[model samples]
Target: MENEKHHIVPYRVYAIVLLVLVVLTFLSIAITDIELGSYTVVGALLLASIKSSLVLTYFMHLKFDQPYIRIMVGFVLAVFIAVVIVTFFDYSFR
Candidate 1:
């Protein structure tokens, strides 16, 4: 399509995202070492989710994709989240 233009993300953005991912990785290790009671898993998972989202948004180039693609990704994410919640509830209750 001649009307569609290529999306060019700057190297600087990638570098920053990489640095953030590294920091989050270290934080995840720190979370494992700290005595956070029941919150440790939550914190680690939150960081992991953030890191994964960054990777998906930038590395996967989802941010530059069409709205329909983003919607599909959102739908998939919702399903994944629902499954995780159901699994967590089942395990916690048992």
Candidate 2:
């Protein structure tokens, strides 16, 4: 029973974080017409990234896992970001 208690605590924390992320996602969508300018998109994306990280780390069981997996995930994320930046620059320049 003691072992089960140790395992369940992290899950509870993950569930709370997931709930908060859902609330934030809904709130962000609801406030779309407020016109916060450039920051509006930035804020939404930042929140989304946080939500994704939480899901990946906890729900996906990456929190207490291997370093190689983290490195691969980080590399993929970096590549994705690079692609986005490149596309943005291309669109802006053209």
Count of clashes, each model: 0, 0
* Residue 68 displacement in candidate 2 (angstroms): 0.4
The runs of at least 3 residues in candidate 1 whose Cα sits more than 4 Å from the true structure, single-residue gaps closed, are 1-3
Each candidate's TM vs. the true structure?
Answer: 0.92, 0.78
- Candidate 1: count the clashes: 0
Candidate 1 lDDT, tens digit per residue, 1-94?
8888899889999999999999999999989999999789889889989999999999999988899999999999999989988988998999
Error of 2 at 53 (Å): 0.7
State the weakest 10-residue window (summed lDDT) of model 2.
1-10
Best by TM-score: 1
